[model samples]
Each structure stands twice: as C-alpha cells, then as structure tokens.
Target: MIPMPARIIAVCNQKGGVGKTTLVTGLAEVYTQMMGKKVLVIDADPQYNTTSALGLSGPEFTLNDVLYGDESNNQKIFPGVAADAVLEVGEDWQSPNHSELGLIASERNLASRERDSMMAREHRLRIALKGVAEEYDIVLIDCPPSLGLLTVNALTAATHALLVSEPRVASVEGLAEIVTTIAEVQENLNEDIDIVGVVVNKVRKGRKDQDVWIEKIRTDFGELVLDPLLPDRELFAKAQAAAKPLKSFGSEAKVLRADLEQLARAIWKGSEA
Candidate 1:
C-alpha cells in the first residue's frame, strides 16, 4: 500500500527576525519527538538557518539542487531529483528522543534562484516535492523573509501557511504584505492554499508596546491568532545556537517545550481535519 501525501505547510513572514525559522524547527521537533510523527523540513530560506539549527552541516545535496536541478549533467530536473537531495537527521542524533527527521537542506546559492530567468518558477517547488513529500506525515517549509520568487514557490507548494510575527509595529505591519501575498497566491497560484493561523512569536514580558500590538492583532484578525503566545526566551536561541532541540535542555526548557507542543497539536488537529 502506498503512503498518503504529506500536508505541506509554509511557515512564512515577510519581516526579518520574526523567528520564522525557529517556529519551523519547533513545529518539526514537536511533531517528531512529542507526537512520534515522521516529519520533513525544507529549508527554503537562502540563509539555511533551519538546516544549521537542526545540526546538519555540509549537506552534499541541498534544496538548490532540487529547485534548479543538476543542469550541468543534464541528468535530473524538477520532480525527479527531489528524493535524491533529502538527508536524514536520525533519532537520538542531535537531541534525545528525536525520530528520524527528513531535510532538504538549503545553501546560499539558492538566493541566485530568485533571479533565475526561468518560466513557471513559482510552481517548481510544488512539482519537485510531488512524490517525495509523501514519505513524511508533514512537510514544513521555512520561507525567506521576503515575498520574492522563493517565497512565491513556497506558498505555491504549501497546502497551508502559518504566519509568524513578533508583536512589534514593523512585524505586525509586515503581516499585511504576507497576507496579501497569500491571497494573491490563492487567486493566481494554488487555490487550495489556506492560512492556518498567525503565530505571535517572541513576546516579551512588561512591554506595553507588545501588549498593545497583540490586542490590535487579535482585534484585527480575530481567532486567527493562536493562543499561549511564544515568549522571547533565551533558551530558544541557546538551543538553536547549540544546534539541538529543546529536549536537550531537559527540565529547563519545560515551559517553551509545552508552548511549542500545544501549538503543534493545534496544527495537527487542524491538518487532520
């Protein structure tokens, strides 16, 4: 019997430093370690922060190969070589209790793809992942902090999108750009693409500005804003800097772990529905 296709989700934000890559890895870790689900992370961002945070280094084949293909050899192209580029960060490898995690790594060369003179580039990502994405229960794409070709490809490929933002004026303002981009993608690209919700990330305590913005977002977007907001904790950065999951921190990471698990569960429930 063949496996069902993964629910591809793009974790997107048009504003830089909104923790979009962090959320992508957090959700992937939750789905894998906490829920025992097979997960794949596509590092669509040219920065390749997700690939680095997951403790993968010097990946021979990256998302660049998948997107542009091995044109030098005339051997592989879109949809055919996607599987060839995937690498596994296995259980108990970087962090404890981790299940096998699939990764289509990214490199700085991917930034060039944005300027490539190619037709139908927006659909290339979707075409590449066609059969390869089915091996996992979920595929999370870490989109760049811009509404450029790479992001367009990610949105085009995703079945759903989770908008990430910090409760700041700039980040909040940038949400409209991404939301409008999603709307345009729905209108012109993938009609099936729907926004899962907005993730309020990096909320700091005692910041009245953060509070005001959170309230404003809730008023504006309603229930689309997910609850139990992610706090601006040093542990999140520490874990990423250490190139490990929160589980590696043991009890010290309990609170952030719970928050991530809760949001992951919400996403899981919605995806299943």
Candidate 2:
C-alpha cells in the first residue's frame, strides 16, 4: 500500500513551543535505538532546533542549499550525488544515544527560500528525498512553526504527519487549521499524504484549561489522537542541553522513554495501515 524507500513522517505544528522538534528527535532515537531502523531527519525548520537538539551544528550543504541554491546546474549542492548532502551522525556525535540517525541539517539561509522566485519550490524536498531514497528506512522532517513554503514542501514530500499541539483552545484551533491545509495539499500536491496521528504534547495536570481542551481535542479528532501524552517534564530540557535523548538520561527517563516508544510504534503501525 505505501510506496517505499522510507515512511516519511512530517512532525509538524504551525505553533511554537508545542514540542514539535522534541517529537522529531525523540522519534528519531526510538526508531534507531529501540527499533533498530535507520532514520534520516530533515531539519526543514530555519530555526534548526532539531539540528541543535541532535547536538549538531549547521553543515556545509544544508536543506537550504539543496532546495534553493544554484539548481540550474546540479540538482543538489553535493553535485551529482544527492545522498552525500545527508550526513551520518556518529555514536560519539553529541554523545548520541542512537547511531542509526542521519541528517539533512538546516541553517539560517533556509529562511531566504521564502523570498525565492524559483518555480515548483514546494517540490524540491520531495525531489531531494527521492535522490537518496535507498539510504534510510524512515525519514522525519521537522517542519517550521508556520504554514510557509518550507512547511508546505515538507507536507508535499511526506506520506503522513504527526501534528503536535499543546492542550489549549488556541491549539485546538491550530490543529483544525493545519488539517485544512493538509486536505488542500492532498487534493492538489501529494494525494497520498495524510495526518496519521495527533500528538497532544506539553500536557499539564490539574489545569482546568488544559483539561477542557484535552477533551475538546479528543472529541474533534477522536481516534486520531496518539497516547500516552507527553508530560511537561524537566528532563526534556536537560536532555536537549546535553545533546542527548531523555532515555539517555538513564533511570529517571524511564517514563519518558516508554511514552516516546509507544508513540513511535503507533506511528509506524499507522503507516502500515
């Protein structure tokens, strides 16, 4: 059913501080460390939080150059070999907890892509992925917190999406708006694309506002919601600061690791269906 090379999932939310990048990094580790699958993470966000979270600085040819640079000559910045633009992370890289991860990093120049007058700008990402299709079992794109050209490009390239959101009224509205965009992209760009699941991140206990919106999200999206909800935890910050996953934090991260593993399996299983 699913066309292959990899199951590409765009971990996206057009709202900041919603744990979008964290989900991408977490799932990357889960697929690599836990499931023993290779993962290629596309840091499509100009903010490059995913690139930072993975403990990597910007590389020579980031997604920006691959997509928007001098394309009249070569298809990618790495000349004839596109996968060369994809850099593999070492076990010692940022004290990596998962070595089965490769990255198409992003940098500040990606922001300039929006102002580009190039044609079929949104299709560039899809083209780049195809160039290196044989290299990974899964691809995760961390989209920027906006429905801009970069996000649209990721959506067009992805087979499914994990829409992240905080549990709030505004967040619910954001989910609806993103779903609308997904529908449009499906109709016009990538018909096989879909929002496979909704991740309710940054959930706070005992907050009446959060409780109300959590119920609202479940009611509106129903079975699309994937659990268990990622709690607001301090270890997340510590792990990112250490350039490692919460699971790499050892015993204290048991609960965090379990939650992410569950979510990751849910995503892969959904892709199968």
Candidate 3:
C-alpha cells in the first residue's frame, strides 16, 4: 500500500519570477517519479504559469469553479488534458512531447472571482481543497506574488510554507515580508501553519555578493534556511518554454538534480516531523 502522504505545502514568495511555479512543478514531478507518490498541484496564481508549464491550458473547470462556483456535480469537475500531452525533457537535454504526470490547471479568470467575493469568503480555496485532501499523497499550492486573498487562502490551507528566494538583496527582502505574513497567518488564521523552510533559488556559487546575501539570510533565518540551494540554470528556462520540467530533460548533472531531490526529501521529512 502507498503510505498516505497527507502533507499540503504552499510555495510562496511575494516576488514574481522567483521560480515559485517552477519549483512547485519540478518538485511535483520529483515526488511522483522519485518517491513514487501521487502529487496534485493547485495553481492559485492568476498568471496560470504553473498551469501552462504543466502543459495544461484552455481550462474548462479550474480551482475557480470549485472555490467560487460549484463542483458538487461529478460531471462539473474536469480532468485536465492527458498526461502524455505534457512536453518531456530527455537525458540528452532534448525535448520530447510526453509525460506521465497530473496537474489541476488554473485560469486567469480566478482573479475575477476573488474580486467578486467578500473578504471572509476569501478562504474559499482552502475550504474547497479540504474536500480532496485524501485523494493524493501530497498537494502543492503555487501562490501569487502578493499577500492578497489568494495567498492568504493558500497559507491558511497549507500545513507548511516554502518561501523561495533568489540570492539577491531584493529577493531576500521580499522573503522577509513573506515570513512576516506567515507569522501573522499562524497567529490569527491557522495556528497549525508553520514555515517549512526558505529555499534560495537561482544561486550562483562562488560569487562574493551572492555568498554575502546567502550568509545573511542564514544568519537571520538560521535553521529555517534549507540547504542545497537550487542553482541558476539555463535549462530551466528552456524547459519552461517547451512546457516541461528539468528532470525530464535528462541532464544528470549532480548538483542541480541533487539540490532538487534534497529539497523534496526535506519537505517530506519536515512534514513528518
């Protein structure tokens, strides 16, 4: 029997283009392929970048329908395109047109629903997701680049949060804001909510400035900073354009693969703790 993986992790950072969607999608793939776990990704961002990166588009039914409208009817829940439709990255770093994975696509229309709803009902995403909590081994929520209703709902629903940051002063500053927000959410909204750790992405090794910022973040956050930083890689951008993940690309460079794998294990073990 597959052990029940009931952890819900939210990848959040108040800064856009900081690899939030990329990390979530990549980690989902790792969890499925490496750990033999079923993972569900909830793209809560209006950009739908995660949805697109996962090769899901033209959504008929999305999280919006579940949160704002109604998914009480079985027919109303639309499973996204077949997994084989997703682009795949090969071992030679070649691109292919197939994958064996799953994703719950998101739509830009979700923003409109947020605007129409009152503040209290903003937690609809959290409430809606609770219904399917047991369906998958893990659920990853990709939050928007702001502390809005969408982000709050993600934080409230998540058992833990992974604050992704780039090795830059601005990105670290943005992480601070997210940390503060998580504290607020834990105190008032979800007492069980805790920060899993901070993931420093796009890290350039041996750079003096990058090392400085990284050390500062470690000093400030201490054990909250996860080791094995995700290095900046051009392949990631290429995979995104082709709508595939890095691991699919088949490049077995030890550093990048090890970092991501370690990240997945860290999250899993942290949840267990």
Candidate 4:
C-alpha cells in the first residue's frame, strides 16, 4: 500500500520541462495500480498536463471554484467537503484490489488567478484541502513551474514537499530560489511542514556530469535527497503518449513498473523520517 494517514506532497520544481508533471502522474498511477491505494491528484498547475496525461477533462466546479469562490452569489466553493469537488478519472488499472484515482481537474481559468494579489490566494488551496484530508491515503499536488502563489499555496497545504529535480548543473542552478521559497512558507505559512526529499528525475545513465551533480545534491541536502534515482527511459514517454499508467503496459514495461515501485517506497516513509 501507499503511505498511510494521508500525505499531501507537492511534486514541484521552479523550472519547466524537468519532468515535474510526469513524476506526479506516474507516482499516482504506481500507488493506485500496484498497491491499490486511494490516490487523489490535484492538478494545481495551469498547464493541466496532469489532467490530460490521465485522460481527464476540466469538469464544472473545478479547483477554480475553490480558489475563487463567489461569496456574493452564495457559491460555496468547498461544498461541505473538498471531496465534492473531485472526479474519478478513466478506469482502474488494477482489478480486485480497489485501485481508485481521483482528480481535481484544472482549466485555463486557473491562470487568471495568478493576477490575484490578495493574501487569501496563498491559503485558498490549503483551506479547501482541509475539507477532505481524511478521505485518501495519499494526495499529490502537481505544481506549476513557477514559485508564485499557486506553489506557495501547495507548500502551505502540504505535509511534505517532494521536489522534482534533475541531476545537472542547469537544473540545480535554481535550487537556491526553491529553497528560499520553501523557507519563507515555513516561517510564515505552515510551520509543521517539511521538505521530505528530492527525487532526481530521468537521470541518463553513464553521464559523468550526472554523477557530479548527484553528489552535490547529497552534500547540500544530506538525507533529503531520495534514493533509487529514476532513469531516463523510453517507456515513460510511451506511457504518457498512451495516456496510461506504466503498469497498464503490463509485461511490456515491467521494469518501468519496478522503478516506480521503488520510488513509491522511498516516498511512503518520507513523513516519518
């Protein structure tokens, strides 16, 4: 099974094209299909890549509803519970094990909220998630590639921050900024939160530079760098293109499925450590 007691992890990175969305969607698929865990994925990113990759559409009363509730029109954005805002996507990949997938789909309207200068914008997501934290074993929030209000909101609501990163000089160049943002959030927004670890994404084997940067991350963050680094594989691209989970490929991509299982184990114990 996946992590217990409901974990809200923001698989985030300030820079785009670093496999942020891929990791989030992939892990959700792993937890549900392999372990039969109830996983809730919040596609907080305006790009909505997670929604599309999972074959989900932006439904009515989406995350936009919670972020910009119309108090004047008596529109309760978090109607009773945040569970009311989620929709199950596609079909279960693993049968007889109760693998369930839930999503809070996003739309282009989500980008409009970026202009919102109100302080309430940062806490909007956290407040909405509180209404339904008890319903799932794990909740993954896919953040946009910017450390704006949306990212801060995810940091504020999250129990742990699972930073999606690459083992390269260019990728780690902005690591300082990411650290600063998380520090600010902890000092101001959520004191109980912690950065669980960093997942080095799509590490191309035999790259000497990758070895150098991998050592750098460990030296800088210590135990915060999660192990069993995910490799760059063609299967990842195929799975996304197929709009299906890695496990859905069955024996064709069994090795990819094993890689994801290792990732899940590393994240499952993150909260306690």
Candidate 5:
C-alpha cells in the first residue's frame, strides 16, 4: 500500500507557453516509472492538456465532478468521491508500470468553477482529495497558467509547490508574481505548503538572452534553482504527443530521461539547489 497523506505538489506558473503542463505530465511519468510511486495527477487546469497527454480521452467523471459533484449521481463532496472520478492511465499503451498511474482528469467546463461564488471556494479541491490522496505516494496538481481561483485551490490543497519557467525575460518575470501568490496562499490558505524548487525548463543552449535570463534566475532565486537544466528538446513533445513514456523513445531519449529522473529524485528528496 502507498503511504498515507501523499506529498501533493502543485506544478505552477503564472504565464502560459512555459511548458507547465508538459512538466506536470513528465514529472508524473517519472514518479511512476522511474521512482516506482503510485502517482495521481490532478489536472486543475481548464485546458486539460495534461489529461489528454496521459492518454485519457473524454473522461466522464473529471475534476469538474470532483469539485462541483456529479449531478447525475447526486453526489456532493463526500468522502471518496474524488476517488470515484479517478481513472487508470496507459491501459491501452499496454505497459504494466503505467497501469499504476491514476488521474483525476480535467475538462474545459472546469474553467467555470473558478468563478464560482460559493462559500469556501478555495477549499473545494482540498475537500475532494482528502481521503483519495492517501492512496498514492505522490499527487501532482497541474495548475493553470494564472494566479486565479483554480491555482489558489491547488495551492490550498498542496503540500509543496514546484515552479516551472522558461529561460526568457517574460517567463522569469512572472516567477516573482507566482512566488508572491504562494506566499499569500501560505498566509491565508495552506501554511504548510512550501516551494520545493524552481525548474528552469526549455533552455536553448548558447542563446545570449536566455543565458542571461537563466543567470538572473539563479542569482535571484539562489539555491532554490534546481540543476541539470532541461534543454529545448523535440523528444518531450514527441513522447507527450504519443502519450508514451519518455524512455520509450529509445537511445535518443536517454539523456533527457536521466535528467527528468534526477530532477524527480531531487524533488522527492526535498533537496535545494
């Protein structure tokens, strides 16, 4: 059996096009495949890209059902309702290991819940996953690219936060805002939530501006910046496109896979720098 009270990590970025969704699915895959953890991915984002990348298509019970309850069954946020929404991934891919991966998928309708004026809106996701989270060793929340209610709900539920950014001025600039948001969440919502590290993703080697931005990120964030920078690779897109494991791409995917595995290790170990 997996450990009780899973380490829930909210993979967040306030800016779009920074590959936040990609990192979520990649880390989920790593946690399950390399580290042998029972993983549950909560696609809190409305776009639901992470849901699709995980090979789940048109799931009937999604995060929407978990948050607002499945009206068809007249089920509200009761104990284990979130578990009811979870579906196993990679059954079609025929990988026994991938079978361990579970997901509370997302759909476009999830976006509307953010504007929900109901009381205790930020606590919805937390309430839904109470008993369900303990079934997995790791729970990764794929937050939307905005510091909105959805992101706040993810923060309110998470035990840790992993900030992902590209080596660009615009992307790096948004990091401060997200950091501030996390701080706010700690002050008001979930005080136990901590930032594990900052992942500088999609680095283009030898690009002058990117080099400068990466340095700035390290200088500003200090030991919080995790190492083995993720380079801009087509393999990430390819593997995600096929809904296949990164290692399945063969020899060409070795280095990137190793990097991801190492990164996953660092995150799970709660290492800094």
Candidate 6:
C-alpha cells in the first residue's frame, strides 16, 4: 500500500524574529519523535537559519534548484546528518535527530534564484515537494519574514498555514498584513489554501498587556487562534545557541516539550477540521 500524502503547512508571518523558525524546527522534531510521524522541513528562507540549526551545511540544491531545475543534475541532494546534529527526542537516535527531520537545506545562492519568471512561482515548491511527499507525514515550511516570491511559493504549495505571532504591539499590528496576504493568495493563486490558525509565541507569562492582546486577537479572529501559548523562555534562546531544539535542552525543557506536544495535536486536529 502507498503512504498517505504529507500535509504541507507553511509557518508564516510577515514580521521578522517572531519565533517562526523556532516553532517550525521544534514542532517538526516533536511530530517525528513523539508522535511517530515522519516530517520534512523546507527552509524557504534564503537566510538558511533552519538549515544551519538542523546541522546541515549549505547544500548545492536548495528549493531554488528544485524550483528552476538549475541544479537538475543534483536533484537528489537531501539533507544529510552532520556531526553537530542536536535534538534528542527519541531513543532511536543517540546523536542529534537530524535524520528524523527531512530538511531541504538552503544556501545563499537561493537569493538570486528568486527572480525567476512569475509563471514559475505558483508551482515551484509544489512540484519539487511532490516527489518526496510519500516520505513524510507532514511538511513544515519555514517561510521568510516577507511576502515575496519565496513566501508566495510557500503559500501556493501549502494545504494550510500556521501564522506565528508574539504578544507585542508590533507583532499584533503585523497580523493584518498576514491575513491580507493569505486572502490574496487564496483568491489569485491557491484556492485550496486555508489559514490553519494563528499560534501565539513568545508570550510573557502573567503580563497584563499580553493578556489584553491575546483576548483581542481571539475576539477578532474567533477560532482561528489556537490555545496554549508558547511562553517567553530563556531556554528557547539557549536552545538556538546550542544548536538544539527545546526538547533536547534537558529537564528545563519539560514544560516546553508538553506544550509543543499539545500544539502538534492541535495542528493535526485542526487540519481535520
């Protein structure tokens, strides 16, 4: 029997530094390790932070290569396990669980390839991902912090989107931009695409202002906002610096691990809804 096709989810927000990469990387780890689902991570950002965080060196073939077929001779270049592979969510992998996370590693050259023909934009990522859809249960795309071609490609390819925002004034203001972009994409590009829900990240615990914004977002968006917020934790920064996921940060990561697990379940169930 054939495997079910993966659910492609784009973790997107127009604002930068809102923990988009962190959520994508960590969720991918949890989905695979805890839930036993195979996962693929697409680093659509040219910065390749997700690529490096996952311990993959700059690969010759990025989404650009697959988009333009520029490196047609190197289409098979998937992420390979590196020595520094970090996250340890399961007993199966003693080293970092890089192998468990399928990454289409990016490089600096990806920036130049963004200028490809407009017609090529719609199906670039979808076409590339089609070949590997059977390998994983889910594909989480780490979109760039802008609504450019890279983001357009992600939106077009995804079945749904996970919007990440912080409990900040600026991040709240940026939510409108994200909603507008998603609307435009659904109208003009991919009709099947939907906003899965908004994820509130980096939330400050017991902050009055944070509570106010959270309620405002929920009231405005209704059920589009998910429950169980990701708190602002120093461990998140430490995990980034250590090149590991929150789940691998040892005992300090327990609460975070539980939260992410709940988040994963929400994602799975939301997809069904």
Question: lDDT tens string, model 4, 188-251?
Answer: 9988788888888889888998999988888888888877788888888877776777777779
Candidate 6 regions off by >4 Å? 71-99
lDDT of 2 by residue, 142-198 (tens): 988888889898999888988999997777788888898899999989999978899
Candidate 4 residue 184 Cα shift, in angstroms, is: 0.5
TM-score, per-candidate, Cα-based: 0.94, 0.91, 0.84, 0.91, 0.93, 0.86
Q: Give the whole-model CA lDDT for all candidates, comma-separated.
A: 0.86, 0.81, 0.74, 0.79, 0.85, 0.76
Per-residue lDDT of candidate 5, residues 56-137 (tens digit): 8899989887888655664345656788888888654333564378889999999888777767788888988888898888
* Candidate that scores best on TM-score: 1
**Per-candidate total of colliding backbone pairs:** 0, 0, 5, 0, 0, 0
Question: What does the lDDT read for residue 178 in candidate 2?
Answer: 84
Off by over 4 Å in 4: 1-5, 71-81, 92-96
lDDT of 4 at 253: 79
Ranking by TM-score: 1, 5, 2, 4, 6, 3
Task: Please identify which of the two predictions, 1 or 5, would achieve the higher TM-score against the true structure.
Answer: 1
Off by over 4 Å in 3: 1-5, 71-101, 252-254
**Candidate 3 vs. true structure, TM-score:** 0.84
Residue 241 of model 2 has an lDDT of: 70
Q: In candidate 4, what residue range of length 10 has the lowest lDDT sum?
A: 73-82
Estimate, for each residue in 1-273, the C-alpha lDDT of model 6 and write its tens digit.
Answer: 876766889999888999987888778768877787777788888888887777666565566666655344533322221111222232322224334656676777778656766445566676666656556678899998887888888998899999998887778777879889989999998898888889999998789998988887888788888878888888877776666766666789999988889998899888763
Question: lDDT tens digits, residues 1-273, model 1?
Answer: 988867888999899999987888888888887888888899999998998998888898898878886577552455746778888763433334545688899999999989866767788889888888888889999999999999999999998999888999999988989999999999999999988888999999999989999998898788878877999989999988888888888999898889999999887766663
The number of the candidate with the highest lDDT is 1
> Regarding lDDT, does 3 or 5 come out ahead?
5
